[model samples]
Target: MAIDWKGVFPAVTTKFGEDDQLDFPLFEKNLQFQLDAGVNGIILGGTLGESSVLSLEEKGTLVKFAVEKVAGKVPVILNIAEGATRDAIELARLAEEWGAKGLMMLPPMRYKSDHRETVEYFRATAKSTSLPIMIYNNPVDYKIEVTLEMFAELADLENIQAVKESTRDLTNVTRMRNLFGDRFKILCGVDTIAMEQLLMGADGWVAGLVCAFPAETVAIYKLTKTGRLAEALEIYRWFMPLLELDIHPKLVQYIKLAEERAGVGSEAVRAPRLTLIGEERERLISLIDGAIAKRPVLPEYHSIVV
Candidate 1:
């Protein structure tokens, strides 16, 4: 599949049943919701998707399901977060075969590899398949930063294409643009700074809050790119509180709770990640409800002048 590497691509939540099983029917509905709102692509098995606990078989199932469900309307990407290099390589191969348009890869999980090993992990995985790769550079959470120097080294690999820029230093967007030119596409990984990064030269956004508020997320991206900064900022300001939920330790649960309030999803999470309860749950519900109450009446983003 060809990937444009631009626009709003949601790192969507994995829909699970109260029994802790994949909920295909609800998942299909939410996918349609995002597509209807004009998301450019779908990313499965991501951090927001709860990839850590998913079996390789389950990951493969998601890739294949999303590919078939989307039916070429938009690209479907699979997040690769294996703990071993060999496993990452295997997943990369399988992802391509399963019809993932691209791979959003993390620097091999669990252990903190140095710059050299991190480069090797991504390099070796890229070499395993023909699929395009978006290296996830979220050192704040991942512990290893794929520096500009590291990116210079990776430039030779044609398939190691874009990056999900989550270093949290908004200047990194300009730094990446200055250093790499158009060689590597930069997608803002943190929702809180998405508008600032896009203004700074990010090509797209790998958004988390988009899972619940798809239209608002896409509207922000469309409005900004089309030189409607003021319009975008108004909506983005409205979205800030909910967007911050993506940066938390319990992001999966928090976002799902938002999804639940929006009439788009469930709050059932897998074992070891029980559903939110009591005060914490009520606090988030208050926030989500409050935001939904004042949801912006958006402009016709699809018809915006470029």
Candidate 2:
């Protein structure tokens, strides 16, 4: 598939049944919402998807389900994050076999590899599969930063096509564009800084909160791309509070609550990840409720100007 690697590509949460099984029905509903909202692509088994908790079999099921559900309307990209190099390679190959159009892979998981080791991990995974790869550069949570020099080193790999820039440093976006000049596609990975990064020439968005608020997320991207900053800012400011939820430690619970409030998916999560309860739950619900009550009526999307 020819991926433009630009626009909204939501990092959706993996819906789970009360029994902690993969909830295919709700998952499909969420994907449909994203597709209907006109997002550019769908990324499955991401951090927001709670990929670390999912088993290999469950991941395979998700890949196949997303591919079949999307039916080529948009690309279905699978995220690969493993502590070992070989495991990552195996997952990448599995994604390809299951018809994923692209791979969004992180550096070695759990173990924080140095620059050299990290680059090798990504490069080895890239070599082991034919799938185009988006290197996830999230220094904040992952603790391993893929610096400009590291990216420059990995630049020779043809399948290593794009990046999910979540370094949280806005200047990194500028530096990437300045250095690569679109040689490598850049997607904003942090929700809080999404609008700032997009305006600074981020090619796309690998959004987290979009799983709950799809339209508002898409609207921010579309309005910004169409040179309608005033309009985009209107939604961004209203959406900012929810966007901040994406970066929280309990992001899964927070986002699922938002998803429930937004009428997309259930708040059920796997064990070790409890459903939000009591005052904690109440506060989040209040945030979502307040936003819902005052939600802005977004203008229609225009043909992307940039």
Candidate 3:
């Protein structure tokens, strides 16, 4: 289950029951649904996965569950979003012990670390485990940008191999390619700009809305990779409205609601992040319903592989 670091990797949301417990059946069903749609990897405990609210033991359970359910068919990556360096290192080590094939790591969770601290944090964590790491570089949200110089400093760390490119500057993709060659595999993190990033030489997408619209997301990626630009754009235009939902502050609730409406997921979110209500709910429902009512016919994309 080596991570080639290509294709659609969904930042899947953690499913929950009315009782607020982890709903294993629902989780597995959605996970299997994503896999069946031809996604390349599964990312557990990411922002969408509610990593902040999950207990240490809960995170371990998810890794074990995803690993077992995925059955080594694809790489299951556990996201480590710890605030402390020591804790991040411990979690990285535990991920390997729990059978995680790879890791997607964010910078120090609550604190906005400076360049040196950020590099050190990633350096220390990546050095801790044998698991291949995809550095989550979303400065817009996480507030810590892994600058090119910082990446160069970490270049010698073989385990810190790939990046979830969320800087929102698409040209940074070319910058990385020009600077390091392929030393770092780049996966587009923003759903809205995915096709653009892919068209510009991104290796893959660490997608958000794909949690709900798995098949469409994969279709876009496969279509682009296969050079079916016209077909890809057709779907991408239709998917744009849905993809915009991923950038909101309440992205978890927004995407979960999309999932619920799509009949592949539920709307139950953890506390401090309640489900959408009022105009927000109405607006999203209308959007999701309209998209479903007008769901585009996907051309056969399975033949095209990345």
Model 1 residue 192 distance off true place after TM-score fit, in angstroms? 0.3
Taking all chains together, each candidate's TM-score versus the true structure is 0.98, 0.98, 0.99
Candidate 1 similarity to native, TM-score: 0.98
Cα lDDT tens digits for candidate 1, 1-306: 678888999998889987788998889989999999999999999989999888888888888888888999999999998889999988888888998889999997889999899889888888888999999999999888999989998899999899999999999988888888999999999999999999998999999999899999999998998888999999999999999999999999999999989998999888789899999999999999999999999998877533
Stretches of model 1 off by over 4 angstroms after superposition: none
Candidate 3, lDDT over the whole model: 0.93
Worst window of 10 by summed lDDT in candidate 2: 297-306
Error of 1 at 223 (Å): 0.7
* Residue 262, model 2, lDDT: 90
Please give the range of 10 consecutive residues that has the lowest summed lDDT in model 1. 297-306
lDDT of all predictions: 0.91, 0.90, 0.93
Q: What is the lDDT of residue 42 in candidate 1?
A: 95
lDDT of 3 by residue, 196-258 (tens): 999989999999989988999999999998899999999999999999999999899999999
Per-residue alpha-carbon lDDT of model 2 for 1-306, expressed as tens digits? 978899899998999988888989999999999999888899988888899899999989998998999999999999988999999988888888988999998888889899889989988889898888989998889899999999999999998999999999999988998898988999999999999999899988999889988888888998887788999999999999989998999998899989999999889988788999999999999999999999999887744555
The best candidate in terms of lDDT? 3
